[model samples]
Target: MKRKVDNSYGIIPFYIPSEKIVEKSKGCYLYDSEGKQYTDFESGVWCANLGHSNDRIVKAMEAGIRQSIHHGYKFRNHPSEFLSQELVRITGLEKGSSVFLSSGSEAVNLAISMARNITRREKILKIHNSYLSAYGYGQITPGNNHIENVHFNDMQSLDETNFGEIAALVLETGGASIDMVRFPDYAFIQELVELSVANGCLVVADEVTTGMGRMGKWFGFQYYDFLPDIVVTGKALGNGYPVSAVTVSAKISESFGKNPFRHLQSHQNDPMGGVIGLEVIRTIGDENLLNRCLDTGHYFKERLLFLNAKFKQEIREVRGRGLMIALELDNSVNGELVSDLLFERGFVIGYKANTLRFLPPLVIEITEIDKLITNIGEILELLRQ
Candidate 1:
């Protein structure tokens, strides 16, 4: 007799998972237990930028595992040191310092903590529609006293705010969590940063989803004119590995030296995490994936726009940059149903309310994108009836 499988026996029901058991993954594709192949348009929760089980990243991780995964807080690792240097160099945080963590939420919280400690302020500010972190000061809530919200792309909101009491303005440029890939206005961000800085409030860029060439730039903050005081990176940073980083500017690092804010975690600077992160950065640079991401993203958006024009009654709008794209359905159309149909067709995407988000791997080919587009059009035509 064959044994019956119980996939969800002990798993917490935080979110419902798919029934298909993923057996293997490689370069923007997932294979099921039955050997069916599916394109991973969501990039495995927007983490696998270079794609799932990238050979280079896997080799780096294997090497790190052979040497050491963890050294605790007492001893230092060369991987962590080298990774920090690379992060500082890429972010243009001259003489800055970096610390690795296990998740985006932790990195975001650490950045907020640093800003509060450095500014000696009690409040954090964020865009009304932005999603910063899963917990801590970054998580916006109605009852949260320490966090305040300013409307995105609204100058009036900025004009009314008192930056004097704010510690940091946490900015997340693009993500599925915040109504799907909404980019902030250039002028609004510039003024917001200028006003916040003038009032002694630091700017913290939450690049957890928008970093690692997801936005066709090294970091989303680069899209704007100003440089941020602190940067929190995760998701694509380790290319599917659970590693996050908090990088502070030279000024913030200097403040830390004088003020001394102690923060310790078990995996704070694990060699494996450092090794994976460094490999991810190096691979993206060596492959010239940033420019490729730009070109591919433009092509994808154009195709999506063409679809929008074709199905005027189905697609409401197409938005986002780089690999982070969203296709919002019309009010009458059901996005979840559309997503399910696409999943059945061997393509996995993200759906929230009326938005269908696509965060494909940077290594995704134009042919793969065309396949997805064709599937979407066919699905839409079927749903129209």
Candidate 2:
């Protein structure tokens, strides 16, 4: 028999298909072509926070399509207006205005651009192991690197060094690693923010993955004490839609408004995208999803801890908060093998750097959580045998 092969070639092929192609999805479960259901822990690359085919999001998309879809970058519309207002209110950035974009990468670029234009500096500081975007200006430069990398744990005398040449200090709220989910050290983050203020460097936070209630908070920055000059958010912003936004504080916004800035995309302020964003936020608030995340996250971590305790030799550490968790298994356990075995057992998860990352939907049920835990336990036992 000739096996069917996918013609799509551009993707990184990080997780090659091990079973039937996914046909449809609803809530936290995905249905494949053969009608077999699998639990989704990755949330379609961490975007489907409200779950798959959410009624609210679907309805919003339908109605938004009827009303208006895209208004050129120059004109403003109701969906974008309401979305911006809601985003400001949800993010608790009272004096900040939102600019919609298509993806996290776009938002990151725009935020970096804003930071550079406002401070008139080229040197951007970033923490080590933080992911902004592959194509984002945060790390990309033509010749000499303009971005400075700082280690979160090894900031020995960074504060003493002069940051006069730095324009912005971009940061990812939580540092993700193969061994553990590393939330930033509070005192270290505070020092960085304080130094940024003292040195006149704009602080831009890239909340591409940690925002939209993923960290059991409205935004990841809320976990800390300071507010960033610019906040770049995406991934779960539209709950699976291709949407993102860069939020600028009133102070920096005014500075950019004074001058002519050249940045625009065809789908910059699409009404459908706005509607999706609005509905997703509304659903999260109305559904009390934040509290739910805290509750379910506690339970999920408990189960993971129990598993780690039982499989001490195979598991190295369990880290992360809320639904964003990771299982750092021992080196002997092939991460890809574990991923493939779990996938064959009707479970879907993320594997990177010998770690099994779990980013389940905020609406995931207790039963689904149990299914994942049980399958993992079975897989480990089989591996042991």
Candidate 3:
């Protein structure tokens, strides 16, 4: 049967689909049109914090939709209003205001615009390897104009001294890794945040993967012990629903004053999605998932450390926070060989091809971590031989 062509039609299809298919996803599992079940550790590209079909998220969306699919922007909506308030409450950002978007790139664009408007500055500065937004055509159409990408580690240099012309410095706290994790030091990161603020450059944090307890903190900025002028989040906000948000402090949000367009995006403040986001927040708090991430993160972190010592000659580095971990292999190991070995052995681990990534579902069991460590260790040993 021929299927209708839609968005996601081009660019890159990492996994070729022999036939078009759809599936019912629940928890961390996807049951495809072919009726095969696959467990996903990527969590919808790290968006589904509470997993797919979370009871709270689903119920909230369903209830809101049954009442009204959307609340026109003119009339203030409860879900939107409450979710913003709740986020402000949890974030420690004084007088927090939120602008909703359907994707992370839009959130990034909004934050960038907010920075320029507030400071009355023009240039947008970014650090290298930061996933401040997606690389889709939608991003190219808008935020691509004045955006600047620089190396995150290139701070305290001649280039960084040129911030006089920049309005905001947006950073992705998590280091870059195609399939691996590359987190940096708390002190080093804190310096960047502080330096930007001191230099009259508003700091914008892209927490799309670090929010909703993914990184053992409610938000990644908390780990740095500093506040950003604005923070952008999307992936885990709705626990699987299409929702992203821009959170700002009172000082920063005040810049929105007299702006002709507020949330000008047509789909901003869609009620059903907002309700799901509120629920995602509630579930994270009620389940104490932040604590779980810290505990599990530490436990698994040790295993990676142990692996490094065990395979020092073959392991270049191991890094990450909480569930967003990565194992960087030394140049000696054939990354393709290790990736294929793990996949063939029934483990659905992900990789940057050159590095190994472990973004297992937050709900992963203790035994599974053991299994992953053991399987990886065996693979390493085999390679060494």
Question: For candidate 1, lDDT tens digit of each residue in 91-162?
Answer: 989999899999999999999888888889989999888888887777767777998888979999998999
Name the runs in model 3 displaced over 4 angstroms.
1-22, 31-37, 135-145, 148-150, 158-160, 176-179, 258-263
TM-score of 3: 0.86
Q: Write the per-residue lDDT of candidate 2 for residues 1-385, one digit (tens) a residue.
A: 1234554766555545554778999999999999999899989978898999999999989998889988675677888879888877866678778888889988987888877877888887877668767575754556537777777656775754568888888878774432246777788888888888899999888888888888788887787889888888888988888999988777876786676587878888888888999898899999999999989988999999999999999999888778788888999887778888898888889888889988889999999999889989999999999
Pairs clashing within candidate 2: none
Instruction: Please identify model 1 stretches exceeding 4 Å from their true place.
Output: 1-8
Once fitted onto the true fold, the runs of candidate 2 whose alpha carbons sit more than 4 angstroms away are 1-19, 139-144, 160-162, 175-180
Where is the poorest 10-residue window by lDDT in model 2?
1-10
| Candidate lDDT values, in order | 0.90, 0.83, 0.74
Question: Which order, best to worst by lDDT?
Answer: 1, 2, 3
lDDT of 3 at 28: 67
Deviation in angstroms for 178 in model 1? 2.3
For all predicted structures, in order, the TM-scores are 0.97, 0.93, 0.86
Question: Model 3: which residue pairs collide?
Answer: 47-235, 128-150
Error of 3 at 17 (Å): 6.3
